[model samples]
Target: MLFAPLSELYGRTRIYHIANVGFIAFLIGCALAPTLNALIIFRFLSGVFGSCPVTNGGGSISDMIIQQHRGAAMAGFSIGPLLGPIIGPVVGGIVAERLSWRWVFWVLVILSSLLSLVFLAFSRETYAPVLLQRKTDRLRRENINNNINNNAAALLRSKLDAGLTPRELFLRAILRPFKLLVFSPICAICNVFVGIAYGYLYIMFTSITPLFEQQYGFDGVRAGLAFLGLGVGSMLGVAYFSSASDRYIKKKAKEAGDLAADDDDGDGEEGMVRRRPSVGAIKPEYRLPPLRLGAVLLPVGLFIYGWTAQYKVHWIVPIIGTTIMGSLQLYLVDTFTIYAASALAANSVVRSLLGAVLPLAGGPMYEKLGLGWGNSLLAFIAVALIPVPWLFMRYGEFLRKRFAIENL
Candidate 1:
């Protein structure tokens, strides 16, 4: 949320540069911290800084690519974060075993520093508002010396005046995601599924260590290799579905015709039909098919993992199940990123708030219910919510029309 808003307010290039620098600093701090508390604080700060890519990646794709091409672009971005959770622990296990846990932070510092430098050297601004603002600023400056018509200057001055104060903008940014959560049924349902998937992931992460050690009798390093299944699954899912999302959207837009307007943009005119395909023709349903497939597979994977683990099935069985779960989970994350961005374009702040808070509830949910039933319970809940995407796909136009969110 902060990154997106900042990208709009300032510029994507500047915020990207600033965020990378801050990420490097926080990573170094994490490496240097003597106490666990300091390490936690630094990690949180690092997350705040690191969130730049996650938040802005969607908007960046939206800005740079036309709607027809955004799915593949988004899919490419999804690969990194989806694979991180799986890969991080595996790498950390090796580093900690060879050196100490502190080396985990040190390793991250070195890696993040290198990436930061690379980004600093190559990244460019992509947000349209920021780009336009820069153009406006440059034009105004050039026109200032001439006694020529100051139309651009007047426009810039008006824009600056019409802009919300920092406080109001900040509040709007923060609350918009939440408003989407409360009001948008599509967002609310997706949040529940996404939140559960996240919680299940962490629970699996925490529980796998013990399960592998106790039941399979593997050491930390060997046990951590099990995560490879999830990593591989996630990678494959992103490769497969990310492109699928874009294709699906394009296909739907063609079928729905050019009259389909986005709820986020209020430019649909019944008679303004164009024979050619355009970004405006795309609908939110393009984002849903992948999510629907994910929703179905997610629960089935959980049920398999839970029951198989409960019965002391072969390690490979649970691992296979987990791989499936991981793939579905990553797909959910990718879909939600696009969904939230599309559903609440101007109110991304609220989406970020939901993103942050929803996962907090997952830890406790798993703790009270052991792996099998805990996941099963989640699966059942997911099943209940499966109708959401379908509802939105069939009737979303009416809902958008009724609520007039297109105008908001």
Candidate 2:
């Protein structure tokens, strides 16, 4: 959340560079820590600083890509975060077994440094306001240098940006997400939904070591390889959603084309038609899986994965279940494209907290309730919330208009 707002308030590139440096420094701190306490502290700091890219990434994408084409862009961008888990387990297992546990931090440090260098060479500030602020600064410099006292554009920009103090901007960056989360039902529900899915994924991560190692008696390397099913599932989810979202939007646009007059700046989901846009707007529900596919598939996936793992069914069966549940929260970006940073940051808080805390309960829950019942409990939660997206589909605009955050 801090980084998300900071990127918009300051320059996105500057925030990334600072966060990268902080992340690397903390990783090095972890690699050389003298005690477990120190290591834990360093690890926490590393996560805090390292997450800057993800927090700001949605907003940057919003700045660069129109909503019409963002789904495809997000698919390519999401591959890293979604598929990243597959790499983490394998890399950590190999590095710890071959070298030492501390070497894991060293490996991350090296990779992060390389990424930082790449960003330094290529990454540019993508936020529009910050770019304009830079232009304003240049105009100020030029006006002063040339003694131009009555530059209309410069005066207007200065007046427009007049109360934008650093402290005020910082507060906006930090507080806006919370405001959206608290005041906007759409934002809140979406975050909670995404958070649960994210937490479920982490819970699966915690389960993998024990579930595969003990149940199947897999060797260490093979246990790490257990995550491959999920990796494949994640990729499948991304591919299907990307294609489905684009197809759905295009179809909706074709049907709504009569309402569109030129519609040059019309972003499909935002306002696809200029004439009577409210009636022709592509609803957020259009981004959802048609016929409640995601709603049913999520719980179904949990049931299959749980029961299969419970009864020692064929590994492939569980993999197939995982494939069904691996799909997750991409539509929120489309739902609030201009405020994508605040929107994603809202999820960041819920998802990060849930992702961290839920896994801690995984071991005890699985031990007490066993895999089948434990997963059934989660599936029950999913089933209960099935109406969330549907409700939005039917009444999202009314709710959005009625509870508009700025009004509050």
Candidate 3:
């Protein structure tokens, strides 16, 4: 939350560098800590720094990818984080067999360091405003040296600079995610919906280990095999969503175009006047239908997994449930264009809060309610949130323009 907005104020590469360095430092702390308290603190700090990539990735995609291709690009980017929880246990199980718990952090530290080096060597600044700022500087120097004043860059420079002090600009930058959360109905509600989705995901992940161990009598490296279902499910979700997402959006866009063409006379049934799209050429709401399908299926998946796990039914059934849930996520980036990073940051703030705290309830909740009822509770909440996607797809464009974030 605090750091994500700085990328827009500074540059994506600079923020990446900061996050990479901090991630390595705190991860090393986690690796070296002798006490559990110290380890927890270091882990917390590491997570704060580690989130930069996911938060800023949407912004980077907005800078580089065209609208039509972003669905595929976003899916590719999304698969890593979604798979991380499911895959982490597998790697951790292997590392724990041969090495201490600290070695897990050590492994991540080594990988993060190597990735940082590559980023330092090759990653270019992708923020358009930041690039413009650089060009404006060059233009200013050239004009100063050559006695050529009032260049075209000046107008843009003025608009960007806005005579704000650095402190004011920083405040504005940091506050934007919160502003969107507070003021933008789309951001707030979508984030709440995302929070519920993420909370359930964490609940399932946390609960699965013990459930598998108790029900299947799995232990040692074999226990890690339980998470294989989640991994397979994540991959399946990735493939299905990536291939179908763009196709669905294009279909919506074509339908919209046809409607506009038919509305050439600006008539509606009886005396009702049709509300033409007031946002961009392709409404962002076009991206909502698939997400709606995902949302509806998510609860259904949880119900299946919960009952199957409770009954100690065939192991594959719960896995199929996770597959459904995984497909339902990757929600934020698909919704916004320019402020994708801020949008994601807003979603992440709520998501991380629920993700962290909700799982604390998992052990107790499961103990009391048992697997079936506990999961049913979560599923029930999800079912209630099903209306979010439907309403957003219906009226999101109106809300987006009504609460548009201007000139930040």
Candidate 4:
């Protein structure tokens, strides 16, 4: 909420800088927290501020990267969140065992602080509106006393003034994403599959420790290493899909005659038609292809990981299976996030709300069912949702036509 609105208001660079500083401060607060309550407070605040990257990273990518290159950029940006869970616990466990839990926060505080300073020193403003505003400011100051014609400056000034106030801007920023998520069937269905995939990922992360330590007789540090598979898989997925998505979009655009000529204004509507691939086309099914592949692999991985670990089969078997699952999971997330961003161009808020809620619910679901069964159940649900993206991708344009949301 804060990220999207602030990015539009103060610009992405400003928000990124400010949020990083807040993140460092909150980390320090967590380090020095004297009580559980204080720690929780600091952690929650850090999460609120830390959300800046998750919320605006896509928008930032969209701002600078053309549709053809956004997939790769998004994939690269997505690495942090994907790897954090795996890396955080390993480092935390080691630091806590060798030093203390306080040191964990202390270390993070120092690192985050250093990174924040670096970003502040070097990060450039990427939001076009903000950059344009800066130019407009310079122009006004230069022409304050001149009677020379300045239509461009006058028009830009009017536009800047007509821009939404901070309060109204923030309200619309927060509400619009929700409105899209609620009304856009394409967004809604894809969000469900993405949400489930994410929820299961978290569930698996929590469950892995017990499964490894108790079942395999691995110690704490060794058990933590199991997460390395997830990290590796995530990185591989990002590297592959990031570039793949961009190429796929470009290829589809060319096939659809949406590719604009060099001298053209780049305002043509050709590519939008290809955004949802035709059912009979030789083109890859952009929306559902990743989801369908992930859906099939996720359950298979779960079954293999669960039953093998349950029966004390070789550790390598489960590891291999989980690795495949992890990679596919990351791919699913990257694809859906990009898809949602594209479909709900102006409404990112709703995408994030659902993103936030699904993870919270995953814990409860896992707690009620044992790890093996819980994951298996999630996989089963994923199977049902696999076709949702396919349906949307095939019929989405028609739905959009009937609903006439473009006018809205």
List the global CA lDDT of all models: 0.71, 0.75, 0.77, 0.71
All predictions: root-mean-square deviation over Cα?
A: 5.3, 4.7, 4.3, 5.4
Candidate with better TM-score, 1 vs 3: 3
TM-score per model over all chains: 0.85, 0.88, 0.88, 0.85
lDDT of 3 by residue, 23-140 (tens): 9999999999989999999999999899889777877887898766678788788778888887888889889888978899999999999989999999999987788888777877
Model 2's TM-score against the true structure: 0.88
Against the true structure, whose lDDT is highest?
3
TM-score of 1: 0.85
Which portions of model 3 miss their true places by more than 4 Å? 139-150, 156-163, 254-279, 331-341, 403-408
Question: For model 1, how does the per-residue alpha-carbon lDDT over 1-408 read when each residue is reduced to its tens digit?
Answer: 567656667778788889888887888888889899998999999988998877777777777887677767877787787678778878989999999988897888888788878887888887655566677667667766543435654555575444677677656666666566666665666666566666667667766776677767889898899888788778778776777887788778777664443433446764553465565557656677877777777778788877787677888998888888888766677676666475434323444454455456545665687667877886797688677767777886666556444311
After superposing candidate 2 on the true structure, give the runs of residues whose Cα lies further than 4 Å from its correct spot: 144-163, 262-282, 329-341
lDDT per residue as tens, model 2, 221-280: 777877777787667766676787768876776666656555676466555545533423
Residue 106, candidate 4: C-alpha displacement in angstroms? 1.3
Clash count list over all predictions: 6, 0, 0, 4
Model 1 stretches with alpha carbons more than 4 Å out: 143-149, 153-168, 256-274, 340-370, 406-408
What are the per-residue Cα lDDT tens digits for candidate 4 across 1-408?
Answer: 557777888889888888888888898899899999999999999988897877788888878886567667877887887888888878888888899999998998888888878888888888777787788678668766444326665665575454566788778766765666677765666666666667667766777787789889988878888888788778777766765666666677667554333425456656533343342332334534555566677778777776677678988877776787787766677676666454433333444455566667655765687556766786687677656656766886676557545422
